[model samples]
Target chain A: MRRAGVVALNTFREAVRDRVLYNLVFFALLMMAAAVAVGQISIGIEQTVIVSLGLSAISLIGLLISVFIGVALVSKEMDKRTLHALLANPVRRWEFLLGKFAGLVLTLAVNTAAMALGLLLVMIYVKHSLERSDAVVLVAVYFILLKLALIVALALLFSCFTTPLLAILFTVGFYIVGLYVQELRNLPVEVMSPAMTAFTKGLSYLLPNFENFNVMAMAAHGRAVPGALILQNTVYTVVYCTIVLTAAAAVFSRRNLK
Target chain B: MPGLAIEIENLTKEYPFGFLHLKKKTSLEGLNMQVETGEVFGFIGPNGAGKSTTIKLLMRLIFPTAGSARILGKPISDVEMHRDIGYLPEQPYFYDYLTAAELLDYFARFHDLTAADRKERVERMLKKVGLETARKIQLRKYSKGMLQRVGLAQAILHDPKIVILDEPMSGLDPVGRREVRDIILELKREGKTVMFSTHILSDAEMLCDRVGVIVGGKLRGVGAPGTLVDMKTQGMEILFELRGTSNAPLLSKATRTGDCYRLQVAEEELYAAIDQLRAAGARILSVAQVKATLEEFFTNLVEADGTHTSAVEVSGK
Candidate 1:
């Protein structure tokens, strides 16, 4: 447990210093800026347009950062032979894996909060006021964090056996496929063969339901976010993240450090 | 009981290719060796000679196909046993964003240490490796030698009983090498067992109390460096400038027929021959007995093709 904390802290420091983190932050900021400019050229629902676009942009950038950095974490350590040093110590493989995930998650949390605050401030300035229920923005931010947690877990699983580039590609591809899983299931059964329907249904259940966590869009339009729905999405993200992280730990334990 | 720091009996590790491949390559074959408590053992080999392979096996970084290794009489894979070992790899890596102190602090948590104890140990180690001045600077700017020193510091921070260093001196300058040598000697002085792998034979000669040399996935030799050098083919090159207008002593030893001296000593007499020359009125100029270095010994063993055991014999009886 102590070893995991140490590893996590070191990983967090290493991740925060990466130039890629800054680039993502910059791009996320630019996205909000673009959303604000587009809102000015808008038809009536300018506040709704700006908030929805800004939140979506932040979430997308956060997802990208989490997957890209998490996938590279283990592979980069192996590439530089640092994993050998860590393994040589009185540390367990599971501890190392958990520590890496924790560190990446902590970094994502900080970046997500910064991005959220940036969008919230712009929203407040535009309306000369912020909505009372705008406080629910925290829930949307939390949901986005949960989603990134799942992405980090998936990226870590890929990193266990593959190169950084391949891991990143597979993780992002999984995210895109996972986002469209609902649409994939809604396709006509008559138009698709039995095997295709089964495979697509299996994929839908296997992949994370990112659409279920789309509270940010509803919140931006001032729509009510049901408490039960947030609870359900949180439970789903937790279970999914747990499974992926466990699989990553299992595979990493068997890898040869040398 | 004060068990051996490391013990391996008939340890073999085989790596099999996939279904498409026909042969399996055994990386370590029937390796047997033991390092007693408080002994400095050197592991030496050429590149791709299975040095790292053996270390990885010892650390349980990879599962062995067969055989077993014990550390302090416990199985190599025993998690609790690792608390007694400290390892410094060839190129020790640290998070570049952290300072020397932070890096050690991060590693210190692995062992059972209080917050106060960790802090004290981290400071002490930084001082020990001569990095106290740079303790606050980010590791990104550290030179290779500095990086190595910090690596050494982290390895020993927990004060492990057995220190395993793989190619620890590979990138050190002469002064840095000497400093590391002093640290190794200090560890030995503290009664800690120190094992390090190095291709530099001279360092092995200076540092190891016992050494095991491996080549082609087999242990070629295991003993004190001095003992191995003595057993290998080393001779005395005596330069005798005859004290003369006459080439009498030179010619007499040469059988008076040839320009070369017919040295008739047996292999054991080589040392005595040089002593006798110094005793005789011959040479008096320079009498130097050249001993085979560990490098030459290792080269001979690797190139000797498993059957030849020709010992270099001196010819002056």
Candidate 2:
């Protein structure tokens, strides 16, 4: 575990030094500024517009950062041959895999927090006072972070076995499919055969249900997220990330690395 | 066995290829060898002769399909045994974003070194590798030779008992190569076991206590560099300057270059040739015996293996 921390710290340092976080955070802030400008043109719904736009900006930028950087995490190491010297040390393969996952998630969390802070400052400037409803925006940002963490896990799992380009495609594919998993579950059973229904139902259960993490609508309407949903999202993200990361470690351990 | 630093028995590795990995290619086959403690062992081979493959398997960067190896009596699967082992891969590429100091410090943390110990060791290693001046610069900005130096620095930062290096002298200038050779010698003087792989035969001849010649996914020979080749004299060569050129007896057989003539004679004919040259009033410049070299021995092994394919052939395949 201590070795994992060392690898994680080095990985986080790599991302920070690469200046990837800076570009994405700057873009998110720019979008929030644009939201502020758009808020002024609207009448009596400035908070709603700002909350909706700010959270959307955070989610979009977070998704991009998560998917791109996460996929490169292991593949780039192997491509650059950095893993050759690293694994020669006493570090376990699973520890290295988990460390990379944790490092990217830490980067995402930092970027999301920076973007969320920018959103809060925008709210303060426009409203001239802090409102209790604005606290819900923080919860919505937290949920977006959970979604990004899940994406990082998926990207890492794909990265273990495929090229970065294919990993990116697979991660985005899973994310898009995962968003519509509830619809897949609710397909009309009257029109479909029993086998098709069972297949779709199994897929719905197997795929990550990302829809559950969407709290932006509730935040834009200034409605508080229920406590139960927050608990569910936290547990779901933990369990899902564990399974994906375990599979990643297993694949990476057996890889030839030639 | 108690004095052995490394031991291998029937170790083999096969890589799967083709669609769905149904077809397999053998990369290393039935390798068995051992290195005594405190001895410098050189693994010499040509390109694609399984030198790097064997080293990678020992480092656990890849797994073997058959057999097993042990380092310091611990099986290769024992992770704890790695603490006493240091490895540098061929053409080692480090995290380019990190400075030399930062990279060494990061690697040291894995050895559980404390802050002060890491700082001291990082500084010492940088100086040892002659990269102290460039320690603060990021690896991306470093030249290949400088990067090789950094690779060496990181490998020995923890001061392990055994060091395994694959092509450590690659990308180094002549002076850099000499410096690395000195480092390896110094490590041996300190009673550390060092195993390095190289295609450069002269380096092996100079520094290795013993060498293993590998070809065609198999080890062909293992012995001391001096004993691996034929010790019998191949012939004798004499360099002489005929004073006044009085039609020396062997002058017709000698090759002339400006002021000197050189002749090769069988070992039994050496003294007779010298007496004849003296009778002809010739001044002998030097006399030397020619012997078979490690390079010739290594080439013979490669040829005997019948797998010495050209680079173009390998690439096309």
Candidate 3:
């Protein structure tokens, strides 16, 4: 675990030096301010539009960083041939994989925090005074970060043996499936057979239910997010991340890093 | 652990190529050898001759298909044993964003060194590699030789007992190569074992206490460089300088090379040629034995049976 932290530190340093992360964070902030301008076009629902745009921008940019950086986490090292030097050390394959996972998670955490702060500033600029209920936006941003963490782990799992391009494709595909998988479990009788419903229910068990993490609608509309919902989503994200990361480590351990 | 620094027993590695893993290409085939403790061992082979593959296996970057290797008396799979050795891969790549100090410090942490120890060691390694001036500069801005120095610095940062270098001299000038040779010798003086691979036999002949020739994924020979090259000596060459030349049959093939007449005296005719040199009042400038070098042996070994890979990319690495 300590060795994993070393890899994590190095990964963070490399990502910080990269211009892409900064560029994405800058764009997220830009969109937050742009949200204010776009919100003025809608008079009565200005707050809704502003919050919606800010939260959506955070989710979009955060996942883009997560998916892209996560897929290249190992592949970039392999291409640079740095993995050879690392594996030769006291570090194991699993530790290295976990370290990369930890590092990217940390990066996403910092970037998300920055984007969230930006969203807050934009909110203050539009509203005359700070509202106590504005804290609801934090809840939504927290879910976005949790969702990005799971997406990062999924990207890592796909990256164990596949190319970065293919890993990105597969990770995106899984994200799309995860978002709508719960819908399959609750299909209407007229639109679905009993057997198909059973199959979709099984799939819901097998795949992550991303819908559980989407508090964006409630948060953006300035409605309170239930504490029960936050706790449930946190537990789900933890379980899903553990399973995905473990599977990634297993695949990486068996990999022949040619 | 006590007798040898490394031991390999019939190690083999093969990679599957075609769909369904139908076709397999052998990278290393039944390699067997041993390296004694505290000796500079040179692993000589052309590109893709399994030198890198063999090093990778010993380093546990990849597993062997059917054999076992022990490093410092521990099985290759023993993670704890990695603390006693260091490795540098061919054309190694490090994080270009890191400075020499930061890179060395990162590697030092893997050895469980403390904060102060890491700081001291990183500083010492930078000075040893002559990169102290550029310690704060990022790796991407360093020249190739500087990068090699950084690589070397990181490899030895933890002060491991054994150092494994795969083409350590790849991107260096002659002066840099001399510095590397000196560093290897210095490591030996410090009682550390060094194993390096290269196609350039001269470097091997100059620095290696013992050399192993790997061709076509198999070790063709392993012994002291002198003995290995001397065992195949075809004849001896005797050179002398004479103001005038009276043709002697033994000197029939003598050619004027600058101010000397070079003659290849047969093994049986060596004494007879010396007798003639004394009789003719010639200055016996030098009596040197002609023998095949590691390069010649390598070439002849590859020319036969067409086993080794093409030599085009060998020198590039």
Candidate 4:
């Protein structure tokens, strides 16, 4: 655990020093500024439009961080030959993978926090006052963090045994499928055949239910998030991340660094 | 076996490439060698001769397709064994964003060193490798030689008992190579066992107490430097200076070796060859033994086909 923490801190320092967060910050600012312009034309729904656009920007950029940085976490180490010296240490392969995951997750947390703060400020500027229900967006951002953590784990898993290009393709494929899993599961039983129903149900269980974390619309329109749903999303993210990380460690342990 | 730093039995690695990876490319083929405690063992081989592959196996950076190895009587696959081993890879790459001091601190943490110990060791090691002045500078700004020094520092920062270096002297100038040689000798003086791989025969000859000649993923010979060099010998040749013009028939077929004439003679013809040289008016300069060198032995091993490698097995202490 100590070794993993050390690795995690080192990785976090590398990301922080690399200034990767600047691009996300710039995009968030652009998103908020653009929301102001778009909200000006839709004067009646200024707070709603600004909050919607700002939250979307924050979530998309968070996903970008999880996918892009997470893929390179292992692949770049191999390409640069840093893994040679690192894996030679007393550190276990699982600890190394977990360290990388923890580090990137911490980074995502910081980035998301920055974006959320930006969203809050933009909302205040548009509405000229804070709404009693405006605090619900924190719940949405919290879920965004959980959702992005799962994406990062998936990216790390694919990158453990395959190329970054292929990992990205696979992760993006799962991402698109994850968003439509609800619709696919709710397909009209009257019109669908038995085989299609079984296939969709099996896939819904096998693939991550990313839609579980999608509270963007509710938070933007200032609706209450149920306590039970928050707990469920938390449990789901933890379970899936653990399974994927274990699989990554297994693949990484058997690989020959030739 | 207790004092052995490294032990291997039938170590092999076959890398799969091509479609579905069904076709196998063997990188190491049944290699067996050992490094006894307190001795510097040089693993000498040409390029693509499985030196790095063997080191990687010992470090457990990669899994072996077959066979097993032990470090300090523990299996190589055991993660706990890594605490005693230090490795410097061929042209090692480190985190360029980290300074020399920061990199050492990072690697030192794996050994469970305290923050205080880490600070002390990182500073001492950087100074030991002559990088104290540039300790604050990030590694990306370092020159190749400086980076090599950083690699050396990180390898030994934990003060491991067994130090394995793949090609420690690869990118350094002569001065840097000498410093590394000195550091290696220091490690030996402190009673730490060292195993390093290099294609530079002269460096191996100067440093290794016993050198292993590997070619085509097999051990061709293993023994003291002079012993392997003495294993192969052509017939002895008598050398004499060419004086005026040689008229004798015995001197007719002599080959000129610069200012001296070299003539191959049987061991029994010692007196008769001298008599011929005197009668032919050739001046006898000196008689010196022409023993083979490690380079010649290594060259022969490299040039030998797959069918000719020796089956000599050198085990642990």
Candidate 5:
């Protein structure tokens, strides 16, 4: 566990020194500033516009960072031959994989928190006063983070067995499919063959249900998220990420690394 | 077995290529070798001769297709055994975003070093590898030689009993190579077992206590550098200066340049030739014996393998 922490800290240092978080955070803040400008032009619903645009910007930027960086997490080490020296140490292969996952999650968390804070500051600047319901925005930001963590795990799993470019495609593909998994689960059985219906149903359960974590609409409306839904999303993300990371470790441990 | 630092038995690695990895290419074939404690063992081979593959298998960076290996009486599969082992891969690449000190400190943490120990060790290792001046600079801006020095520093940061390096002298200038050579010698003096692979036979001849010459995915020879080559005297060359030309039959065959005649003769004929030259009043300058070298032995092994396989194919056909 200590060795894994070492690798994790080194990975975090690499991301920060590479200046990846800075560029993404700068752009996210810029988008929130734009949202504030757009909010001023609207006669009413200015808070709604800012809330919706700001949350969307945060989520979109977080997704971009998670998917792009997550896909390269393992592949970059292998490509650069850094894994050679690192794995040669006493550290276990699974530990290294776990460390990489945790490190990227940390980066995402920090990036998300920065963007979330920016969104709140933008809100305060425009509203000239704070609202009691404004606290729900933090909940919305937390949901986005949960969604990004799941995406990072998916990207890491793809990275373990495939090239970075292919990993990115697969992760994004799964995310796109995952967003509409409810529709797949509800496809009309009357028009479909029995096997097709069964296949779609199976895939709907197998793929992550990202829609469960979407709370931007609820937050924008200044409504409280149900405690039950929060519990479910948290549990779901944990279970899904554990399984995906375990699969990644298994694949990585047996890989030839040639 | 008690004194052995590494032991290998029938180690093999066959890489699968082609569509769906159906075709197999043998990178290493049933390699069996050992390195004793506190000796510098050189793994010498030409390109694609399985030297790096063998090292990688020993380091557990890659799994073997067949056979097993043990280090310090523990199986290669034992992660704990790695605590006593340090490895540097060929043309090692590190996280270039890290400075030299940070890189070493990060690696030192893997050994479970205390904070104070890590700081002290990182500084000492940087100085050991002659990177103290550039320890603060990120590796991305380092030269190839400087990066190689950092690779060396990280490998030995934990002060492992056995150090395995693949091509440790590569990508270095002459002075850098000499410094690395001195470090290896220093490690040996400290009673640390060192195993390194290189294609540069001269370096092996200079540093290795014993060398294993690998060729075509096979070990062609293994022994002390001098013992691996033919020790029998091939011939004797005598250099002499004659005041005037003589009709001595041996002297007539001698090649003359700058008032010196050089004559090469069989060991049996050396004395007779010397006697005849003396009779001709020739002044002997020097006498030396010619013997096969490690370089020649290495080249012959490579060429012999090529021809030997081709001959077998022709004969079978």
Candidate 6:
């Protein structure tokens, strides 16, 4: 456990120093600034529109950052042959994988916190006041963090078998596809035979309904978010992230690094 | 056998490539060798001779297609053996953004060293490799020689029982090479098994207790350099300086004869061979048998292989 923590810390430091992290920060800041402009065109929900757009920007940029950075973790190590140093030591492969994932998640958390603070400042400046329930911005940030954690796991798993570029592409593709699980489920089963319908339904059940966890539209309209719904979304995100993480660990355990 | 640092039996690696293009090549054929504890073993080979592949196999960076390699009598597939080994690859790379101290400390932690212990070990290793003064400098600013020195320091920092170095002296100049050589000797003095792969025969000739020559993925020879160079052939000859005149007849009578060369035994023989000597040796110096040098032995091996390689190849081009 101590060794894993060390590896994690090393990975975190490496990731934090990556140029890509700076670019993500810049993009997040741009989005927070853009929310101010987006607030002027709001139909009615001035503060709501600003906060929702800011939350969406954070989530989207966080997804890109996680996928982009996470996929390259193993490939970059292999490319530079730094992995040899790690392998020559007592570090386990599973430990290395977990450490990278944890480190990246930490980066995302830090990035999310920054975005949330930026959005909060903007909301206060634009409205001259803030809603007490605007703490849901924190909710939105937590949800985005959880979702990015899952993306990190996906990127890591793909990294074991593919190049960094391909891993990122596949991971981002999966993220986009995961969001359309509702549409995939709402497809016309009557047109298809029972077998095809069952297949489609099975895939829908298997893929995460990223849409289900999206409370941006409701939060933007000032609808009350029940504790039960947050709980369900949190549980789903945790379970999905765990499943992907386990798969990544399995693949990495057998990964051959030369 | 119990003290053997590494043991291998028919280890092999076959990398499959070009599945879509309908071609594939096996990188490593069946290779078998072993190194004992506290030995400075040299794995010498030409380029693409499976030296790096063998190191990779022993490190378990890749799974073998067949056979087994054991470290400390435990299969290398076991994670426990890693703590006992340190490896320096041919191209040792690090995060360029990190200072040398940070990189060393980061690696030290993987072995569960405490902060104080890691600092001490890192400092000791850095100083031993002469990188302590530059510890705060980012690795990107380091020269190739400095990078190699840093690599050496990290590889030996934990004082592993076995240290595997692949072409560790490739980019070093004379001074750097000597420093690394001294470090390797020091490791051997401390009873650590040091197995390093190299194409430079001089390094092996000077540093190795046993050297294995590999070519085209086969173990051509394995033994001390002196023994390998001495095992091939032997020859003897004699020369005489007469008082006033040519002693052709007397010399022929005293010298040995064989089908390869015959002794000239008369004035007539001298007269006939005089023209040959005039054409070959304008001034005849004293002739004597000279024992073949190690250089000659190595050249003979490469020449005998029938590749028609140039002299540079023999000199590790």
Best candidate according to DockQ = 2
In terms of lDDT, the best-performing candidate is 2
Give candidate 4 misplaced runs (Cα > 4 Å): A35-39, B234-239, B249-259, B262-269, B306-317
DockQ of each: 0.65, 0.85, 0.83, 0.82, 0.83, 0.69
In terms of docking quality, model 2 is: high
For residues B1-317, write the lDDT of model 6, one tens digit per residue.
43788887887766554647355345556778889888999998767667887898888787788889899889898887888999998878877888999888888877778789999999999999998899999999999889888889888888799999999999999999999999999999999999999978789889999887766555677787788876763543323333333434334444432312333333335544544544433233333334555456666665566432322232232
Clashing pairs in 4: none
Question: Tens digit of lDDT per residue, candidate 2, span A67-174?
Answer: 999999999999999999898889899999888888888888888898888888877777777788778999999999999999999999999999899999999999
lDDT of 4: 0.85
Q: Candidate 2 at residue B6, lDDT? A: 95
Candidate 6 lDDT over residue span A41-130, tens digit each: 765567767866787778877877788778887788877888887788887787888888888888888878877888778777777767
Interface CA RMSD, all predictions:
1.6, 0.7, 0.9, 1.1, 0.8, 1.5
Q: What is the interface RMSD, in angstroms, for predicted model 4?
A: 1.1
Of all true interface contacts, what fraction is found in model 1?
0.76
**Which of candidates 3 and 4 is the stronger one according to DockQ?**
3
Native contact fraction, candidates in order: 0.76, 0.86, 0.84, 0.88, 0.91, 0.84
Expressed as tens digits, the lDDT of each residue in B1-317 for candidate 2 is 43999999999987766789897677788999999999999999988878888888898888999989999999988887889998988998999999999999998988988899999999999999998999899999999999899889888889999999999999999999999999999999999999999989999999999999888787888999988886433788999987566676688999999869999999899999999998998899999987778998888777776765742133133
In the predicted model 5, the residue pairs found to clash are: none
User: What are the runs in model 3 whose C-alpha is more than 4 Å off?
Assistant: A24-32, A35-39, A188-196, B241-248, B273-286, B310-317
Error of 5 at A139 (Å): 1.4
Model 2: number of backbone collisions: 0
The 10-residue segment of model 3 chain A with minimum total lDDT is A20-29
lDDT tens readout by residue for model 5, A6-46: 77877788889888787655765586667657666876677
Candidate 4 displacement at residue B298 in angstroms: 1.1
lDDT of each: 0.79, 0.89, 0.85, 0.85, 0.87, 0.77
- Chain B TM-score of candidate number 1: 0.83
